[model samples]
Target: MSGHSLENLASFVRDLDSACSALMIEGKNLFAGSHEGVLRCWDSATGDLRWSVEVAGPISGFAVDNNRVYTTASDSLHAIDMSSGELLWSRELEGGSDYVKASNGFVWATSSVYELEVADFIEATIWRFNENGDELERWIITERPWYFDLHKDGGALLGLGRPRCGYLKIQPGEKPSHHQLQTESPVTSGCRSSEDCFLLGHADGTISSIGSDILSDSDSNSLVTDIASLDLELISGHDDGSIRMNGTQHQILGSIDSVTLLDKDGWASSWNGSDTQITILGDTTNTISHNARIRQMHSSDERLVIGDELGRLFFLEAEIVKRRRSEIGELDDDENKNSEIRARLRMLRNR
Candidate 1:
């Protein structure tokens, strides 16, 4: 364990009109979608704006392949050309599109309908389409899926809710199969660690694995809010403002909002009303606090991208972050300049 410190600050874009709701990083590009329905792409290395586009509604999620980016806005799924940011096609889905993933030359999306009278999601549908935006198949389920991941076989693995209380497996052009678990809590978050391994977290703070022999059951006594995996290591965030890495618990500032992996290290972000904290887990753990709440985060290789509630986007690199922390550690005892340095180290772009 290492002492927690605030240091890293990187390039940022602060012109968004609403909170950033979704983020994805691929290759040299960083993609962000906002609550105001604005989607923008930036060069991950230079922080230069590549393009921006407006869609039908607030962007909920995004999926990117080699040539296209697919996003779910309102009840419609929009496909945009990756390079030019031109709209290629848009298709309306019943209920509302909540999640989207692209793999193996195909796209998969999930939509759910909420029953206001019951105050819960009543049904959901899984849709599959080709790269050309043509629908191929769909399967409807009675329970809403709390989480889903794309399987290596080009199918969808869904963590289901009440009545099922387990998982569902949907293969391409085949009938859906399901296995019910005899548990009181539903799966809340999950991630595909490898081609053959999937880890799932439950509301009762239990962690389970499918197809992996290394993971064993662990309990945290709080709801698992998010999970991210790299190779064989697993990092999970909980509702109790704690993070578990391979069953080792680390305390943070607030309840965790999201967790992700930048290269081999695991990063978790949490919000406690006035500030947002981003903690890195590895050989030497570090945490950075920000003024704005982070809405979404994603990473690629050594680079990290963050979208915050104040509509700002930040880009940081692992080596640069370490270097910045080292620079901060050498500051002198001048109060006035130290005050300015602390402001800059908050990681918010000074406007």
Candidate 2:
């Protein structure tokens, strides 16, 4: 496949003052959070700045619902009106907020503090909140979670470390349940692969699925950084600059930071942190280079939003990229034809 520049094919581009730390795409709105504590909403179609809001610290993560955008910045969680970008409420969380998710009309967040004595995070807390910012319930666990995701049945799935190197399940209005799986390493990334299965990637480059018998070993010793699924096919990114699809590894130029399935046709994007580029994998592989390392990426259908460490935001349409690739292929073919004609003329002169 031929390589093409992403900047030439992007639908629009925007800039921020600091590194872009978080990104969320909902409907026609694009929400971007920066390391300098600024969250801005943009019109995904036209690249117009709809609104911008400031928080207390660097934005850690974001979760969006029908009417509100939930954000975790430093040790606080802030709720902002989705339409107006107004600060609805803010609440301080114990330890520090690391991840947040929203499902079934409720918001969930996790926080943890590192202990110098133990050289690790000893305790972690999970908080559940209503739309009005009222805390409905909270749970405390012995070890901090290394990964968190929403369960298929509107609960929280937490992958832990150390003493309890398994998973914890938290349902609404119920006690937390711990399930210790027989594994060689801690879970680093996970996602819902199907209606009845949850795929978890391990630090030792193994993949395990809950409620299913699917197990895969990528054979690479590097940590699995991210996992995504398209139908029954599992795609995983590794720290060794490789991406595995059902145990088939494809090596790229740099360590993989994240991997996400773009559509039903098995189109996927894997971010290469060392090269500061995104490799789109499908029938033909193409790369999109960036000015700085990508911090976050989110996609909806054919549209993609990328945020970089230099605080630049790029909105891309997959259709445009496909067209660009075709053009580059045509150009290469023409060059080859021209070279062949020149060679024939030189042979005639020599004869």
Candidate 3:
């Protein structure tokens, strides 16, 4: 421990084959889902599994408010009670919906692949639903929706489409508007809000702001896999243990405060982009595998919730630990000699 403490909240884990599509932090409870089509919730303090709700098809999207949780799978949407895990209602549409975002008193979603008896056709539709799970209005678009971020105060919506395909801005009741601030390269991860606009981390290791700042670069491939913003600072974690922070103006500010290891070569952090620099509170790196990548981290500027590709979820605080001596060069004489020879051979392999 680095003389720092984590928020010590509990976390829920869902084992998925590819990646997690939906995560909602409802009060102290965390709701998450996977392609397995199950909604898993856990206590945020002890990592205890509280409840699991099974659904049809794969859970493609989720959004939550004070009293209800809404999720979409295949061609249908479901409404569930947050307290008792009760099914409130479900709506099956002509097509399956994939991405969802919540704002104000309404829930918005986009659907492609309208199901037909003879053949399925791709149709992009955006639906707005009231708080009571009632459809209010619908709009059609030419492009499929990759993801949606809500901007309540700004009265605008940002939608991510196929990689480098750019984004569409939808007003309260208007047709979708296209923006050219996107690349053909895939976006690894992104986060959007009404307050801070939208941020995207690309497959080429570059990070760009979509709404206001149009700055983009191909060489700054920081290999960013996840991104989060708080108090005008952006924090992103890479494939390596490296994390970077940038200001709202899109300038690199600092780095990860620390890195902690989990059991399976994974690491977690609770830093929420509070300070000018990133902070890491606890580490299990010495005991876990180094090949593990922190897939998704959810936190405010104060606490952190992290998950890795291995489906391990942990809650950590934002604090820094002192660097420890690496064990790579600490072998005995005979073993060290053999390791040196192998190391040289490995270097030659890269050439």
Residue-level lDDT of model 3, residues 1-351, one tens digit each, is 221122112222334333454555556677776655767776565545566787876677677776678888878888888778888888775567777766666877777874367353356778888878799888876555544677645344544445324666777666667776545655556676336568776656566676576554534455555666554545555544355543211222333323322221223332223332223312322222222344355554344555544444445433311222222333356755754575455345323
Which regions in candidate 1 have their CA more than 4 angstroms from the true location? 1-8, 11-15, 181-184, 329-351
What would the per-residue lDDT of candidate 1 be over residues 1-351, giving only the tens digit for each residue? 122233225544434557898888889888888888999887777766788999866788888887899999889898999999999999899897889989877989999999999998889999999988899999999988888878877788999877677899899979889976545578888888778778888888777777754434555578889888877677889999888887688987779999988766788889886788888887778777777787587777877787888777777787876666556343345744755664564445322
Model 2 poorest ten-residue lDDT run: 264-273
Q: What is candidate 2's lDDT per residue for 122-147, written digit by digit as tens?
A: 88999999988899999999888877
Would you list the clashing residue pairs of candidate 2?
A: none
Order candidates by lDDT, high to low. Answer: 1, 2, 3
Ranking by TM-score: 1, 2, 3
TM-scores of the models, in the order given: 0.87, 0.86, 0.63
Task: Give lDDT: candidate 1, residue 253.
Answer: 70
Global lDDT of each model? Answer: 0.79, 0.78, 0.55
Regions of model 3 farther than 4 Å from truth: 1-21, 46-50, 93-96, 114-123, 154-156, 162-164, 182-188, 193-196, 202-206, 214-225, 236-296, 308-312, 319-351
